[model samples]
Target: MSNSRSTKLHVAMFPWFAFGHITPYLHLSNNLAERGHRVSFLLPKGAQAKITPGAETASDVPFPLHGHLCIAFDQTQDQVQTILSSLKPDFIFFDFSLWMPALAHQIGSKAIYYSVITPVAQALKVPTKQKLEDMTLEDFMQLPPGYPSPSVRIKSKAFEIAQLKVVAEDLGTGMSIYVRITSSMIWSDAMAFRTYHEVEGPYCDYLRKHYAKPVLLTGPVLPETLATKLDEKWTNWLCNFKQGTVVYCAFGSQNKLQKDQFQELLLGFKLCRQPFLVALSTPDGCATIEEAFPEGFQESVKGRGWVYGGWVPQTLILEHPSIGCSVTHCGYGSMWESLFSDCQIVCVPYLGDQILGARLMVEELKVAVEVEREDNGWISKESLSKAIISVMDKDSEIAGLVKYNHAKLKEELTSEGMQERYLDTFIQNLQGLLD
Candidate 1:
């Protein structure tokens, strides 16, 4: 009884302004709350209402969460000092976009960085011979491609690869340099990341030991796939398709398909002769839906296929036995769901980590068939059709292989060893406070 009041773990959860980043933290917060820990998830205004649980409609006086706002992109000495003075989280956790980290440090608060995308630190560092895996660094090992969770294409046109390269140099990649930089500047404490053990094990291992802070790895979370019921007309139509017969085509929240590209995919689905569901949701200019969908394709397929514009309950769709294949942006959430479902993948991944995600799906997982495109990145209808058929054809060897790999990977990830590893890390993080 005393333990309940004595040890109330409090973690302040802050994610970058994106669903992918926010959702995980929400789950984490919920997990913590279920364990009786205090959780405070902050929203910096303009965040979606769907994800935000009971977000206050208006706030006059500054709330604890939105103490002050400073852009991470504008990381200036004076600006940082100003920002730091405002944020006073006890333990600050956020995606990389927020720059108020230096401020948290000034307030003697610990900071932890979660790489919503794969940590590109060493991965992005152009390898000397082949890649970071080939590096002589004992810590270095082969990294399977890093896939991003599906969401809006979060971008900063002002921020380029060149700018990131500069940021890395300024922050220092190694221990001594990073330590010195942290001491001299605003950010305090170290960072952990989320990636699977089998795939990014070597890199994760190195980071766990090298960083001053303990690393937490929670990868490939398999989302619950059945959100809505099957009685709906669309759900009923999906049911008419044979089990493991319908190919699900969805390009996450952030991905956009030009009408031309959308038509190509539509033709691909038609060519496969596989009943399919396509997710088509874009927010304003970020990923607009108007031009991304083939005109009249909806009308043509009215009762034949489904078109989920936004918030289609992906996990539920993936869980359905009628769904056999997926053509996705390779976002982590969708990736794991498909993988765990052990369905065949027909990849048409696009943008940022998705390129790497596609590589992971097609190259590493070896379960998905990638739509071949020109060097300039044009996915012709013919290539799209082939990809669809390759994944959906009942007798296709590739389809069988994909199903098998998915099962195997799912087993490994869900095994006792992985569970032990996570419990150990969580305990250690809790234990660190004793030190």
Candidate 2:
């Protein structure tokens, strides 16, 4: 393919309904727009409203209903096709809608499978040759053929395997989740991931070899600068604590914990004896976080802890001086944020991709520690507290080592022009696809 430096391209984005997927697409769109590419972003009304203020986010829909949301997304194909015909974009960027490649081809536009998850996670779970339906539990327990990382394997735990099985099964759509994602990858003109080679080169290379196509990396795709500040409420509260003395915990928008697990997590924080802030959805069957709290939990930790069930300014909070540690669910976005922040990292993952991300951090990168789980996937208060203390304790060897490693890696990733160079190369490769 010839490299064309002068041609400007038009791109359209249609991401899965989840916030994790939509937010990254928007960031990539903004990056392209800044580089003088004409872009059109297509999403449902609720997602659009959520991106703007004062409207309910599509995340309000519980996780289980995401399958139905995919069905609805599939139903919008005709409308998407009509828009593509009218707009006539040069490329359509998509994640979950399996029919997108055909639609893009119909409109004479190239389809790009812009994966928001880490390539390692996809490489491990998505089968290369065997039929997804033929995948047995034993197969799920082992690593895929030619998987890049020996350290990253699916946990043998029952719940972990069960979670992987769910991803392979049909989500109310007639197509299994494995088929929906793999077929899209097979048909798309090119593939892309929101990652850099320095962090995930082997995995990306593995994908490139398996798919036999151009695989482009867009770096982390974080905003050049945060346009917003920490809300006053968080600022005031965090300021009261000493520098590097507070722990901030947030599972992403969609992970609702079982009531028992939620209480155990809070109790774990209480045991850590650090000033802490937690933002989480209400537990299953509970109307509010307060309702889900363990008995006398409020009175016991009144001065040192705060729990709220609403959207929070997570990025700003991570930037605060008082936040010494972050307890995260290891979603791709959160993983990047925690890596970039100056905080000690602790992971409590709930999904398959998250499990892989946690392994990459805790085992591969040595930048974070993961909370231990029981055989049934229940996170005990003691395990959570131990993981925090291992990283947060002043004299701990593990704490000092991870901090040193994380800082070195962060410096390289955030070096001047690194992200810009990735985006520039990414654009050139997209343009090459046209040639």
Candidate 3:
């Protein structure tokens, strides 16, 4: 530990562009700020207007160009060096981009590599990045030889896996997932994951063994408090449903469904006969709800369902007693929130680590199930209905198991000082580095 008696420090945070990545850094910044550390959270220039003020921004390196890994390396190296020179922070936390650690070293700042995705994902994705770009769904399901944990049963349909491969190829970072994560492992002062020991202990151990470095567990850095009130319209609508009867469907901000998939989802909801609320994106140029939704689909389920175009307060909806199960894209944020709210999860993962997350929830945690798909990977309404009913039917075996898992995970998540322990240990390590 540093001989300096003062525990206070200045920390700078920089995250990637996606909402999933940005939100976690914001949460960590909030925690650090509350604990008396000064933080400078940075973002791209245009995004500054979207978030609350106090964000430092670098110029948006125009996309296609922005997506090039070499451009990111140069841009971040200059931008971060500039920030460190101006702020002279004691420590800096950066997202998954590989170039950052060397940038921190060049600028004489201590770097802590933070993963917004799960550690299991980090281990699995890194080794497979190259092969993933070209592998078929069948080849992808066969886990790579060095995949860290065998306990996790790797599974997902062909088309769904294909979707994630496309996403990976589109990544703006110059390096592939393998290059990015392995580079961070070699260069950073330390590493941090957005998970705890209880959920993924073995994978955590495997990472430590492989990297031979100080791997820190940041727990599930969730909001300390939840929304106390919801929109009046939402409140009024939810009041009509009975406790533990409604299925909440949200595919996350980034997921876009094809027209047929969107229609199948609606048809599944209708078939379940469960009062539900589904939120979907109204893609650009779609003028009205009628145009966006399936033909006469809105009319088909008028009283029993509600459809939202965008921006739903998911936490508030989950907290309401009426919510029994969540039909989700299995994003990390959605998974954690579902665990916290004690909502049964029905996963329909669209891309990237979401497939892994869904697999873990279904196989290891025994808390959720993925929707069944046809031979060609098309999700049928019948399959969706079965998955929904399995979780929502209180008297069913799957329902009982899901509730048991939800309660246990919720207890673990909400245990007093679980979040605090992770944050405190992190600060202590940073303070020690000063010595």
Best by TM-score: 2
| Residue 75 displacement (Å), model 2 | 0.8
Using lDDT as the measure, the top candidate is 2
* TM-score: model 3 vs. ground truth: 0.87
Report the error of model 3 at residue 39, Å. 0.7
Q: Which digits, one per residue and each the tens of the lDDT, describe model 3 over residues 1-435?
A: 432224788888877666677888888888888877789887766566766222222222322343453444446667667777788677778865566777676667788888887666665532355565455433334434554342423344466456555435545554555465667777888888878788877667777766777788777787754536788999898889899888999987666666777778889999999999988875435665457677787888887799888688898889889888899888888888877886889998766567777777887788898897675667888999999999988789988997898798879878998888877887777777777
Q: Is candidate 2 or candidate 3 better by TM-score?
A: 2
Which structure is stronger by lDDT: 1 or 2? 2
Per-model lDDT: 0.56, 0.84, 0.73
Candidate 2 per-residue lDDT, tens place, 350-416, comes to 8777877888888888999888878777888899999999999989999999999999999998899
- Deviating ranges (above 4 Å) for candidate 1: 1-7, 52-90, 119-122, 126-188, 206-213, 221-234, 282-302, 416-424
Model 2 pairs whose backbones collide = none
Tens-place lDDT per residue, model 1, 161-183, is 32223322233223222223333
Reference-based TM-score, model 2? 0.93
Those runs of model 2 whose alpha carbons end farther than 4 Å from true positions after fitting are 1-6, 52-58, 125-147, 150-156
- Better candidate by lDDT, 2 or 3: 2
- Backbone clash pairs for candidate 3 read 67-172, 69-174
Tell me model 3's lDDT, rounded to 2 decimals: 0.73
Name the weakest run of 10 consecutive residues (lDDT summed) in model 2. Answer: 49-58
Q: Per-residue error at 306 for model 1, in Å? A: 2.1
